[model samples]
Target: MKLTKRLHSCVQLEKDGRVLVIDPGAFSEPDAGLGADALLVTHEHPDHFDEGRLRAALDANPAAALWTLRSVAERLAPAYPGRVHTVGHGDAFTAAGFDVQVHGELHAVIHPDIPRITNVGYLVEGSLFHPGDALTVPGVPVETLMVPVHAPWNKVSEVIDYLREVGPRRAIDIHDVYLADIARPIYDTALGNLGRTDHGRLAAGEATEV
Candidate 1:
């Protein structure tokens, strides 16, 4: 499988000549979801689920489909009909030739006053796991983890602990648009040293094998 890191929270995964995209949010490139054989949205947050980009992908490729939670599915299902499927935690499905296991139910609390919303993580092919906006433990061995290195809802200590708990052989940073360039070194050292596992950060558009 080939993993391509996209801007912000979106990522493009290719396997067996099929393409599967996750997130494709407003923070990513407008064409981030384009040319995908399938799409998966973890939540309805604008930074993780951009309706226009999804519409474009589906319009351009009629055979392509989308799998996501209710909030996101509701927005696109009406227009796409059977192509947009509503999925939640414990759901297992194959998208673009990749077997995906959905895990997690609620987004991490951003604040005590803010209401929590639905969220799901994807464990792809039993090897790679992408936990959208949350630090969800898939409760299975993972070869590669797409870790959210920086976010408003989480701190480095919590992220460090999450990484240790999930116990992926290796992890690549995601959900990191909030981390400024100068501050990157700070994260790099902290996660690399404290994570006690293989930790990596891929620049937007970089590709790596797991």
Candidate 2:
């Protein structure tokens, strides 16, 4: 499979001429999920689920579809009919020719007073796992793990520990939109030295074979 990293948490995967996009949110390019055969949203957070972008993508390709949890699915399903599907933990489906297993239940808590919301990760093709906004361990073997390098709900210690726990053969960074450029090397050094796996990141629009 060919994996292309988009800004923030969005990623596009291609195999056998089919494209599946995940988390094409507001922080990502406005047209981030366009041309996808299918799209997956992890949660309702604006950074993870931009309705306008998703609607536009669906409009551009009549055959395209979206899979997401109830909170997000309800917002678009009414318009798309059979094209929008609701999914949750323990669910498995094939999208754009890639096998996807849904994992995780809620987003990481931002604070003691802030309420947590639904969030689901996707283990695609049984090889790569993207845990959206949480440090969810899929409990199944993974070849490549998409690490949310930085976020409000987590710190460097948690990220390193999550990496140690999942122990994939390789890892690439995602959900790093707010990490300042000057502090990037700090994260790089920490995760690279302590993540204990082949870990790295790709610039926006960069692609690598997995």
Candidate 3:
């Protein structure tokens, strides 16, 4: 499969003429998830879920299906009916010709005063794992792992440890809207040295084989 990283946490995966998009949020291109065969959202955060873009994509692609947490499903399912599906931890299903297993339960704690929200990561095809905002480690072996490099809930040290624990064959940087160009190399180098894995940060709109 081919994976294309969009701005922030949005990622587009394509294989055998089918397209699956994850987290096409406000930071991403407005048409990020357009024409997708299936769309998976991790949470309700604006940076991870944009209602306007999602509505537009679903309207344009009648056959596309949306899989997300209950909080989000509660809002979209009423409008889209059969096209929207709610999934949670341990849930497994097939969408857009790819097998997906949902992992994680809540968003990383941002602060003691802020209530945590639901967040579910997707493990696609049993190989590629996207952990959304959480540092969830899938128990099974992973081929390609999407690591959240920069987020309010996490630090570079935590990222390095998460990568080491998951130990995927390859790791791709995600959730990096906050990172500056000057710090990009620092993160890449840290992951390499501490995590001891092949890691890369795909530029926005850049596609790479996974």
Candidate 4:
């Protein structure tokens, strides 16, 4: 499959003429979900779920479906009906021609004062894993891991450790719309120094084979 990193946590995956988009949020391009065969949303956070863009995509692609947590599903189901499906930890299903397994239950704690919200990572095709805002380790082997390099809930050390624990063949950056160009190399170098795995940040809109 080919993976293309959109703005922030948005990722587009394509294989055999089908397209699967994950987290086409407010931070992503307005048309990030365009032409998607399926959409996977991790949570209700604005950076990960943009209602406007999602509505537009679904309207444009009548055959496309949405898979997400209950909180999101509850709000969208009325409008889309059967097209919206709810998934939680350990649930597995097929969408856009690829098998997907859900992991993690809640978003990383941003602060004790802030109530935690639902978050679920996606393990696609048993090869690529996107953990959204959490540092969830999906016990099975991961070939290409999408790491949230920068987020209010995590630090540099946490990212490095997550990569080590997952031990994927490659680590790609996600949740990086806030990273400054000056600090991008520092994070890239830190990921590269973790060991034998290939690590790099994918430029927005660029596609790389995984």
Backbone clash tally (model 1): 0
Off by over 4 Å in 1: none
> lDDT for each of the candidates?
0.93, 0.96, 0.93, 0.93
Write model 2 residue lDDT over 1-210, tens digit each, in one string. Answer: 999999999999999999999999999999899999999999999999999999999999999999999999999988999999999999999998999999999999899899999999999999999999899999999999999999999999999999999999999999999999899999999999999999899999999999
Q: Model 2 off-target regions past 4 Å? A: none
- Model 4, range 18-126, lDDT digits (tens) per residue? 9999999999999999999999999999999999999999999999999999998988899998999999999999998999999999899999999999899999999
In terms of lDDT, model 2 sits at 0.96
Q: Best to worst by TM-score, what's the order?
A: 2, 1, 3, 4
RMSD of each candidate relative to the true structure? 0.6, 0.5, 0.7, 0.9
Q: Pick the winner on TM-score between candidates 1 and 3.
A: 1
Which residue pairs show collisions in model 1? none
**Residue-wise C-alpha lDDT for candidate 3, range 45-133, written one tens digit per residue:** 99999999899999999999999998888879988989999999999999989899999998899999999988899999999999988
